[model samples]
Target: MAATNQGGPSLLTRTTLIVVAVILVVFAFHALYVYTSERSEIIDDIELDVAESLKRLSKSLGPFIESYAVNEYESLVTTEAALKRHFAVIVEDFEMGEILGQPYYLFGQLRQGDGQYVDVQARDTSITEQLDQAFYAGSAPIIGSSGKVLGEVWVYASDDILVKKLDRALLEELFTVLVLAGILSLLLTAVLRRYFFNSILGIDAALKNSDQEGIPKAPVPSFRYRELAVLSNGINTMLDSIKGSRENLKIERRRLRNTIIGTRSGIWEWNVQTGETVFNERWAEILGYSLEELAPISIETWMTLAHPEDLQRSSELLDKHFRGELDYYECEARMRHKNGHWVWILDRGSVQSWDEHGRPLVMYGTHQDITERKQAEASLSMAAGVFRHAREGIVLTSAGGTILDVNSAFCTLTGYARSEAVNQNYEFMLASDHHNRDFRKQVLSSLENEGVWSGECWIPCRNGSVFPTLMTIAAVSNNDNEIEHYVTLFADISHLKQNEEQLRQIAHYDALTGLPNRLLLSERLRHAVSTTRRHGDVLAVVFMDLDGFKAINDTYGHASGDELLIVLARRMQTTLRECDTVARLGGDEFVVLLPELSSGTDCKPILTRLLAALSAPVDLAGHSVHVSASLGVTLYPQAQDIDADILLRQADIAMYQAKQRGKNQVRFFNGMDGSAFNSRLVPPASSDQSEKQLD
Candidate 1:
């Protein structure tokens, strides 16, 4: 094949020729220049030699002419002859001429007796070539000894000497250049031919040995020439690409087969024009039927199996796919299985070929069984509903503590909007500023180790008010068992805590007065009695009744009575020492337990102070109510051991005695006066008498 018509002529040959031609041309020009220069130099040297010879000739003739000025004509002629002979030896093609006015002559041939100057122009034609080869010619005037102008002498030399020397040198140099250029060209051509021939041979062998598929089985042979090596590499790369494409095609075929077999997908092809359809074995298997049983099917088969409601949507999607409105046809639809059960299917397809008029001729697609997926989606939807409506606050966070999701309850509890909470770190919500780096690290460590943590923590709301919550943090793990997120559930227990506190208060204290009631008072009194016995000191139990409390209640209403009782309770508490205990037994009655008392005298001052405090006028409902407290004082460690109840009863009896003995006075209970202070319930009449005395 005409050298396979590679891109151009062989590069090696072209480059070698170009290089050799450039060298030869350059050398030829140099040789010519050197020849011309040598010739010129030879001519110059000849001219210089001629001029020097003329100078010597003139100097020699100068002496002759000077001597001849006084000599005879014969003597002068003889001197001239001698001078001519001297000049002849120094110059080539030597000639000596004498100038007389405009006429000139040689030394030996003067035309006339005075001066028949030899005319150089009158030379024989036979010697004209010789004369034309003249190197240099010049004339100089001879001066006599007295400085008189003598006849001029002309000298000339020919170029024959210069020509002879130039021919010899130039011939030698020309031979050298021709020989050198020949050898170098031959060497370059040989080297280039070897490299080009070998590279081309290797390439041809590679191409010839290539596979029938036009893909090389082996790499192209390497080359010393960089461009040729690049060509080889390019061919090898193209071959590799072709091989890779074939492998990829095979892999794709296998993958398509595996996809049809492995997944719950059934492949199908439909010829739109022919109204015929083809199904793979998997297609029939998905619907609980054998391929043989479903053979010889048409488009009507699908129409019959597809649910009526889904048929319209699937048809619409198919029409859109045909119109190129979508890249593919995809829909979830229900189709009746062979067992008469409706199976949800995910159908997807694309146009495989088109007709000349841009209508779909053939389409291919798959039907994927999605019944399980649908059920799972329903379950997930239920779970989502629970997450949304659960009462407890729920937060989902990344492992890095960035909040990813929050329920409405969380938004309500923390007083943060959903938009504000998402993507925010939970650190800012911790109530305590002192929960520093170490504390946070411990929390993370606990989560990583235990996967769950539960504790009470204070969380601040967006309003900057903090509430206590029972918080539970659980780590949610991914399929790899790595902690991917955190699920935190917390409930605000502040109201629960408040209820517990209220119950405690109601159990131990009087609601209206906020003072310890009878139960708490008795408890304190027992402890006080024990302390008095241990320390060898007296413990006073003083019981007091407001004198006219009932009348005040009757006149101003019950609320005013409660207000008076609250005022008296506060006054009674403030009148005692820090160690003292004051309590309310019932309506209009208060008890004081003073431990560490030295004697009954110690009780007198406290009882007096109590009466004064009660007598202070109390403002009630815009009315000032004057009331007095009648105190009955009882001492612990008196006569015999006594319990807290008996101590209180003795105080009550003493209080009645004080009331009967002109009310608003303190009475002490001792064995000597225990009979006079009888413990009996006060009658209504006597209580009225006491109230009148207070008024």
Candidate 2:
């Protein structure tokens, strides 16, 4: 039979070699078993002989020990021929001791004899220590005349002779077994090579001569063995199947290529081991480039174009796919475009081939441009974030005004939770008194015609309080221009309204007395004069200067003066009618407007009351202070048409006249001419008459 022409050893040769190796191992173990068994037996025989010699020595030592013949005992133990075969012999005298209140014998006297038949007094050596020095040892106790233990005799032996004899025998037996195994292995190889190896060599040659696609060129010849014949037939059958599969795979590849082209997806094939990559034209086009522009493409090219932040994640997914932890590698990463912008890509791949050791070799995948989709998603995320965190309260409603959604800001502003506010009418957010049905209809009409409405309105809260808000409602329309929904934004303007009121108070009122200042008083006076002309009534403009205010202010400080002024202002305000206006022009100077009067004499009672209120004593900073005002009165609609400033000048002239005359006296301005003023010393009126005049 011809030997196999294949490289390395054929199956028959390798099998025969393995059989020879196994046979050698078996025989070696068998030799070890026999050698160990015989060696153990020889050592056992030697130990048994030592035990018997110790027994005899113990018996002979007994009489000598009893008779106190120490020399005889040593001679008997040392001179024994059987004991000479042993490595050593020991003799120990028994010592008496008590343990746990019980008597016991202990080996005390130590005597040793070596294989040379020389005896030694080993007084420092213990019997147990002497026994440990021997390979094998045994002991027997000597019995005295009273049947008490007098001493112990021990014999120890070596296994040197046993080891030497067993090894000599085992070497001979192993040599014969090795020779036989070698001869038998040669015979088995010859038989197998003639039958099994030759048939397998023929099959191997046929397989080796196959085409590049690995399909056998010719069927394997039949073998003498039925199993080998069947194997040859199976190989032929597999070759035919492979040939058909190759054809089908070509068709499938074409179909898949067409499908990829139709879908406009970028196809990529990667030789993972070589770091080589192949990309379709679409792949370059997705990044706004031509395939020719991205020259010399490789795996490194992909890595260079991919976003640096996404590279680590892509590598992790690829590793997982390679390790079989994932069926496919999928990643969404940004790639650098030709225009210097980032383009989003959805990358998906699977390992297509592996090496014999199961490492990834080749992979195929598709790259899809997802930039638009990513932009849309980003826009949606931004809108959602705005809705969630914006400061202005936002509400979404259907066209019919049913609230559909409310944002966190709305929930916080209105004191209503999102779950509580949704599905209610939009009117629930409107203050009932401020936004009536007609107001709502007007808002709806504006939204319908103009598609938006915005103004300041009061918003009702869950706590039943209304807050001012700047609100805007816009109608969302479909493509047909029909209203679909409404989006309302409410900015709480309560703080703005409060700020306006504070600014008005600071600008138009006295800081100390809380009375209208000169700016407001002048405006009111002009309006009052205008009203008197329309109603055909008279109006009085009274100007007053405090009599003793400067002295009190100097004595008790400005704080005390301010307190007194505030108290006096309050008293005068209360004394006058509700239709009157009281204003503090400056330090201790004030103006009072009494409009809608029937006649000029109608002001006398009010003037009397004003003088009494101003003269009253005020408790200021633990000090009692009394102050009075020099009053001057001027009636509007004088003989000549005059403005508010002329009336004020006329009243000032009358106040100076009254002050010259006496403090706490009222002087009336003569409407006939500005040269002289009418002096009227009005008597103080009772509180009841003051009330009646005020009514």
Candidate 3:
């Protein structure tokens, strides 16, 4: 019974509030409508009142005023009387003198009551609301007949009786407003209690009592009573579940971001329709930009970072990918790395996500640094090629002397094909077998200790013929200096041996007479002089110079002179036996190397044969030219002990002494035997030579 009674009051309060609000609203609307109608009527009434007053005033003064004004009023009294009559309607509020003192007559007026005039001096008073306004409160014009408007008529009036009644009716709405305010408050409280407040209370209760997971979900609403509450609770539960799911999704996304960025892998997403792209921070950085540098990415950003050489390739690949022809987008190309250097990367990518139409929406990829590995492989390939194709015989051996690698040059050098030489030991191929046993042990031991052995050795070829070779062997090592292999650069030196002998012959032997030159002569002289000094046997060095050879050269050319010199060198070489050495000093000069002379007189036969040999007429270049040589004989042992140069100098002086004696001659030096003999130099002059020249 008590609950029922309480419910009744609550219901009654709610019903009363609604009823009061409707009644207040009805009254307010009615008041506003009535006020609006009354205001318009008041305005119309003021206008009509002003018009009526003006009509009455005009009627009162129109006839006389118009008649006098039309006559132009020559008389003051006539004009004054007419003006006085016109001002009568507006003269009531002013004194008679003041009214008559106004500037001009009044014909237009709205107030016709009690001789109230208007417009007495051309003052505009066309509108008058004060006379008939319901709420009029303003000043009005007070015209007098004094020809001067003395004052303004101030009127304070209330709205007409009907308007006052309307205003009074509006004022009377206070009791209804109070009733409406209380009722609205009650209604608002009831609605809040039923919907918002009750729902909020339920939520609070659930929050307090529910488990940590969330508020326990309530059952679905079926009835009207608290249906909104049930629905709100259901929405809250759904929102909690959604929030949890969203948070889990956020964590997963963060984990994915960490994986990609930690690996320095770039991720991208593209919208086909809009041609918009999104790339992660590291991905942008890989292209030499920060996340902020390129965002809301477009084709322009990709194009800017892409290598110019790869532009067309990337475009074609993209076109093909969009056509569903390729499943993967993988490429190993150099993308410009950060700081504008090209980096070799393995750019492997896959279509991570796609739209319903099979269009690529997102791509995930990775870049791997493989530049070192690539370079090492290329280096190895080049090394192999050079070793196999080199012109020099390059052989690679194991540290144990097993030949592991050999080039074409090696095959050609040994006259053995590559296959025949492969597994052979390097020591077995050497032809210097007499020294091999000891040499091998030393070389192998040295190579083991020092990692290198390089020297000259004899090696046998394919035909079993032996040849000398210059070989350089070096051990290629790692960082630790452990021998990885041995490289032997060797070449056959057979041609070099023959060349060496030829060079020796050219250096020591004269080409003209096939006799020893000054070099061989000096060498033999040293030995001969050493022997004579030890054995007490005397040695002689005879130096000879050709006399009158210039006459032969001038008569015939250098050819005849060379032939004569050749003959002279040969005869001197023949004059001395094998024990003696004869060599050309140069030109027409010669030196003899004599050893084991019995006496100083033994040089006498050598000198006689040399002179007899030069006496023969020599045929040179088909031209016979008479040539003779001046001989200087110097005995060694007798001339104390002088070196080769001083000995040759003595021989040269003795020869000059001989030339001073006459034409062709020989001179020998004596031990202080200054047999002063002047070389009666006969000049090719004196008119006597002119007769001999003619003869």
Order the numbered candidates by lDDT, best leading.
2, 1, 3
lDDT of 2 by residue, 522-573 (tens): 8999899899999999999999998888989999998888888888889988
Q: How well is each residue in 172-227 modelled by candidate 1, as lDDT tens digits?
A: 87898889889989887888678676777778777866565555568888788899
Local distance difference test values of all predictions, in order: 0.74, 0.82, 0.63
Could you tell me how far off, in angstroms, the CA of residue 693 lies in candidate 3 after the best superposition? 30
User: CA lDDT of 439 in candidate 3?
Assistant: 81
List runs of model 2 lying over 4 Å from the truth.
Answer: 1-385, 417-424, 428-442, 675-695
Better of 2 and 3 by TM-score: 2
In model 3, which runs have C-alpha deviations exceeding 4 angstroms?
1-384, 396-406, 411-449, 454-470, 475-486, 491-538, 570-581, 596-617, 657-667, 674-695
TM-score of 3: 0.34
**CA lDDT for candidate 1:** 0.74
Best by lDDT: 2
Question: How good is model 1 by TM-score?
Answer: 0.35
Which residue window of length 10 is worst by lDDT in model 1? Answer: 86-95
Candidate 1 Cα misplacement greater than 4 A, ranges: 1-390, 397-408, 416-471, 480-482, 493-506, 523-540, 551-560, 573-581, 594-609, 619-623, 634-642, 668-695
Better of 1 and 3 by TM-score: 1
